[model samples]
Target: MVSVRRVLSILFCLLMAGLVSSLAVGYFSADGIQWIDAVRIVLLAASTGWLAWGAAYAFNGLLSLPLKREDKTFELVPTSARTAVLVPVYNEDPVKTFSHVAAMIGSLHALGVAGRFDFAILSDTRDPEVAEKEERWFQRLQLECGAHTDIFYRRREQNTGKKAGNVADFIRTSGALYEYMIVLDADSLMEGATMAEMVRRMDDDPRLGLLQTLPKIVHARSFFGRAMQFSTGYYSPIYTRGLAALQGTAGPFWGHNAIVRTRAFAQSCGLPELSGRPPFGGHILSHDYVEAALLTRNGWTVRVDPDLTGSYEEGPDNVVDFAKRDRRWCQGNLQHGRVMVAPGLKPWSRFVFVQNIMAYVASPLWALFIIASIAAPTLKGVPDYFPEPGLSAVFPRVEQGLALTLLVGVFGLLIGPKLLIVARGAISGVNETFGGTGRALLNTLTEILSTSLLAPIMLMYQCRAVLEVFFGMDGGWPATDREAGSVSLSEAWSASWWISATGLVTLGLAFQFAPEYVGWLLLVAGPQVFAPILIHVSSRSALGTAEAGLFETADDRNPSPVVLRQEAILAHWRGAEASAPAFRPVPEPAFEAADAER
Candidate 1:
């Protein structure tokens, strides 16, 4: 006989599948409401659902505002508290990763926290070339910056569990020496003060298993990069804070830029390799959220301190790059379903999984909905009115203002976050906080325009990921080249044609059936169909040429990010005239651990 869990899982899967199939059949059957009208209803409902969710998310963010810390102060901790900083690296840029470590080490030593904190470079790089680079960089980091701290390097002989496995291995063997472990991504940077503060917070709040920070985007040079940076800075906080509010003890773990209690994590976060095949079965893709859920389920608080600063990460610089990164996320998030039905899972865990599923699935649903709305009028149907019984059994009716409803909901949800960010920035009088209202508004417009175009492309990409996850495709942690700044048109064309095809199909379908709406929607999707060309020209070099009046540029129109000016100036000054201020390098320190008395 099958287990109870398996039986329930089978029943739930069958139920969901049946519901979806019934909807699909009803929408497509010629004998039902005219095919066109049926399609329209499905599309309209799905699109509306997406926009509604987005609105809910916006409000959720707003509601969480009161709970967020407004005054930022670093909580100082005794460095001798047996703390270890864990930097997990997959195939990542060693130079860039080490540069961050060097910077942090200097900052910590400056604050007298170096002696208290030890550094661990836990690498899971599988590629031989990347692994070699990581090794060389670790040694260089030790020579250049690790002397003052106890620096340890360990590469998994087999990168069996990806990041979670790597962390698990460390916890099992070497974790007992440290009271807390600070986790950072390969591209992540956090100040020593923040690290010390996190340690302090963890110590003070014994029930707190994790303390996460809002990571600001840094080193954005490309047009897409700047756009993404703007969005991350402006909009991420609200959503994050909202989630934090709801999850006073169930906050998300974004895998990095956080500190975890060693004992709590070791006891709670041993992720079971999901049973079954590839993609969904073998290894968890987005392990951070799952780990956080596991910890939370065990009565540990997972807090997000959005007020904490000095955390940073980079964005994928272009459209293609963004989608490439998203493909993996799509797979990972979709795979959350495995745990969604697992026994002993928390309600918050289910909520996170559902939210993740919608992130990817909603795109395809919207695409379908958009197509259906346009085709509705063209369908040959029976009499407009048909009903039965006292309950008035009937299909969902098509609203005459369907298009307006769709646009309002989408714009409100997508545009509201930015507007709120702008309002917050203006109210606070922090011009640089969100790159100013002028830039924020412009960024919002650019985002709306760009996302609209790219939506179709992303829809196709997401659909592919969905199918792949269903069919078992692996999106293991790929070695990302942080400095791999540019992509050729050939690369763009080769990678992005599916999106182009999706756009083209949308255009074709819309034009054929919904000519009235097709013109407007096509106008939106045309650039997205050829996003590679548009995105490339929007970069810095293109901005320079356009600035030179090559394309009839009249006044000085600068799209360069104002927030980057300070950092850019520093870089320029360091490169041009003098050497950057050099700090005393950290000398290798020793550690002694006592065995527990028998």
Candidate 2:
């Protein structure tokens, strides 16, 4: 049976959905709607309703502030439990990956709790050269961190199930050595205090299977990167707190930057490879969500601590990189359709799967709505209400006020969460952490403008991703490009040519046939027209983002000790000369010899 809190949360979402859908239907049917308009209305309501549901979380989060429970301080809890800090790597730059490991080890040592944790470098690198680099870097990492720390390195010859498989292999082999495990991505970094605190929390709560930290984006230099960093730092907590309030014991696992109970994970998260081919039915790409569902199914509490500070991760530096990452996520999330109906899953887990699916599915729906609207002028003739049986009127009448209200409501739903989050922060004095009210307000506006312009671009990308996935295209796991860089105009055009073409065609058609709606269409079309410029400029560092006082977070302005340590370690690796020559492709015997030497 569902708890009262869960029931209330579900009802709240449903009520919001109903209200938004009713308003949308009323707006569309004001003129005794054509069939195309009717379909558009339904799609609009669904998309906007999702947005409204999220807004409800932010609002609820605001109200729950005073009632928020305080967490036990980490300093009070003795670090006695054994923890395995698992750093999973694919074919990634070894120097950068190991630097992150070194930073974490250093941070742990500084906390005087290094002995309580062990570090594992689990590699699934297919490239022989990269494998060799990994070996060299592992040696360097040990040398830098000294022999006192328990750091182990292993590489799998056959990359079976990718990351999930890699982790499962470790658990099956050596997971019993530790009481708990902290999973870190190649780019993930966390303060020693934060790591200790997570373990402490798990220790205090025996039923807690997973505890996820809210990782802020760091080292974001590009304009696009800065905007993401700023938004994540400022708004993610409000949204996350709201999710936690509703989720209670059933929270999300973002794969990395989270600690899991070894026994619980080994028991529940040994994912079975779905029966069939790629895309929908192969090895699960998005394994994190499924793992969380499995944990919940087994009655293990999965929680996210929004207030846990000092966890950090890097983001894709450009639009292309972001889309590439999203493509993989899209395939993974879409694949959840198969797991949604699995036996024993909690209702909230099922809803999470549905939400993940809609995150990608909504893009195509939005596209379809836009297309229907564009063609509505030509596709639908004059409405004749009297032609239908039981009709009381002849010509359909348009209600300008109703249409305006619908437009305003939709935009409000889309943009209100950010405003509410900002307001909540100010009210709770959380805005001061983000550099005070004046700075926070300015940053919010900047993020809003930037995100509004980027939204359509993302919509098109998501639509393409969804279509490609449905057509059985698999986005293979690829290492994300975290290096700061800018794309040339030609590169940008190559990536966004479809957007430009769509914008031009959309504007042309609107001007030719639906001149009255051209202003409205421009909101969707204008950004596409300048896609190349937006992509190019946003990827460039010279945008004076810092000078313009655009995207500054408290962490950015005043670096935490762990962040400072990470920066120092990164600099050390970058500045040091290559200790070993680049591994050249050689015969199998030579490779074996190299492996033996290592």
Candidate 3:
């Protein structure tokens, strides 16, 4: 059934692509098809197909039933497997990251399962000053959680291989100490029960190499952050369900908030540096996807349980931060060219590799299409109406009709799935989680508008990143400013001046070569011309407020116990007044007695 669904999904996208390409054929060949016109048509169809592929996923997910989850009342059996909760950090603030650690530790103890799980703060932080701070915070973490041997901190003198290397180092030295490991990022926080449930699932299936949970974004305060939070909480589940349907035994490991079999990962995921230099070579920067592929290649069952909640992570608060993060991801995906067709990988795994690469490559293709359209008139000289002196003078026809049709089709493909989800939410009363159906619809519209405005700016950024990689500029691992504040106009302009210039140049070419396209070009290039203003405004945390009720995710109103626990711990440590205990036991009422041990 899964295979059938996957095949149908592929066919649907191809059909959409072929249909749009045929329309493009008519549109471009109206004056008779030229070589450049063919290029323009192909680009338009490919980019449109990418959008269609995304819509297909959403539609498939909307129809597919969610993965079966155990009943909430199901008793958790005690497992003898020793599991290490590994939190890998790199040049991050000890205060915030350790607070999450303290919260998870307290939650584990409150569940009375601390004995089954131990934690290691795998520090790949290179700065000496940061290392000293990490040690001091580790001491405080022990005291705060009242833990000694259960919580350990290891800092490597040389931060080799970045994060993947950090975990591989742990597997080499201490993989023998545990049966499983829950790898987490610096910002990841999971509830005690979720961790236990993961362990229970792993124990039940010896072949389960990795079990990934869908981690929600928490503690977002800015407008962009809140809007993104709403999208993830609302839309991600539906989309991930579709992914879960497609990814049967060969699944994704997002590198965090996942439980992995220690021996399986240690044996299968020992990544070697690729043969070439930076960018296309060296250690894999996007190690998570590669690790998943490797695990699947080794015959270990890898899967994601989208219904498994209570897992959380922080996101970039503003646009610049998001773009910066995207650059790293683009570089990593580009690196996948080396491993896309390795000897023993599954077909779906290779498709995932292609999917990720096209995500970035699509931007440049769109740009190329636009450029070609603008230059089409001049590139093809006056059509030879009477070739060889006897042909009929077939007059050229206006091309706007099919072009407009293709445009509407592309827009529909992009926004239609989201609207369907909105409609379903309203019908099902699920929009109440997004502050009721009215607000949900309004917010969804607002998100659509914002994304439309931001699309061109992101396109330029991604195009530049891809071009840099092509020309051998490696996107090194950069420290993320996760909680970025506002950006000044000057800063915005400084980062995006080339974008403004590119937009201006495109408009000028449209006017000179394709006068009829000036209006259309304005729509695409106008946003880029004003990108600095958009970036500056979106970065302002003040734009997004809880009182607005525009982006009210369920987490905003009813935060999970783990989220509240982390916030409470953070507040206490940061000297803010706190009104709650270190760990608040929810349904596990029996463990409330263990709260005071902190």
**What are the per-model numbers of colliding residue pairs?**
8, 0, 0
Model 1 residue pairs with clashes: 43-369, 79-116, 91-479, 147-586, 147-587, 147-588, 148-586, 148-587
Local error of candidate 1 at 353, Å? 0.8
Predictions ranked by lDDT, top down? 3, 2, 1
Selected candidate, larger lDDT, 2 vs 3? 3
Per-residue lDDT over 1-598 for candidate 2, one digit per residue giving the tens place of the 0 to 100 score: 2265556665766676677667767756755667877788778767776776777677666666554334334573685689999999999998888878877777777667888889999999889999998998788788777565889999998878899999999999999888999999999998887898888899999999999999999888898998999878888877787788888678999999999999999999989889888788979999999999999999999999888887999998788889988999999999999999999999889999999998899888878877777787666766556776886777655556766777787778667778877777777777777778888888888888988898888888888899889999755333433335777777788788888899899899888776657887888899988887888888888347576567888776666666666666666566563443442211234223322321
Residue lDDT tens for model 1, 321-357? 6767788888889888887886777776787788888
Off by over 4 Å in 3: 66-75, 383-395, 474-484, 542-544, 576-598
Task: For residues 1-598, write the lDDT of model 3, one tens digit per residue.
Answer: 8799889989988899898999889888877888998898789878888988899889987886533322342246878899999999999988799989877876777677878888999999888898898897677778666553388889998889999999999999999999999999999999887899999999999999999999999887677777788889888888888888888898898889999999999989999999989888898999999999999999999999877887899998777888888998999998888889888999989999999899999999999999899889998878767755676676778788887997788899988998888887776666877788888888889888888888899999899889988999755333433335667777777777778889999999888888878888887799999988888887777444667776778777666666777776776666621343343322333234334322
All predictions: root-mean-square deviation over Cα?
A: 9.7, 6.9, 4.1
Model 1 score (lDDT): 0.66
Query: What shift in Å separates residue 72 of candidate 2 from its native position after superposition?
Result: 9.0
Judging by lDDT against the true structure, name the best candidate: 3
TM-score, predicted candidate 3 vs. hidden true structure: 0.92
Where does model 1 exceed 4 Å of error?
1-39, 63-71, 75-80, 374-402, 473-484, 538-598
Q: Which 10-residue window of candidate 2 scores lowest in summed lDDT?
A: 583-592
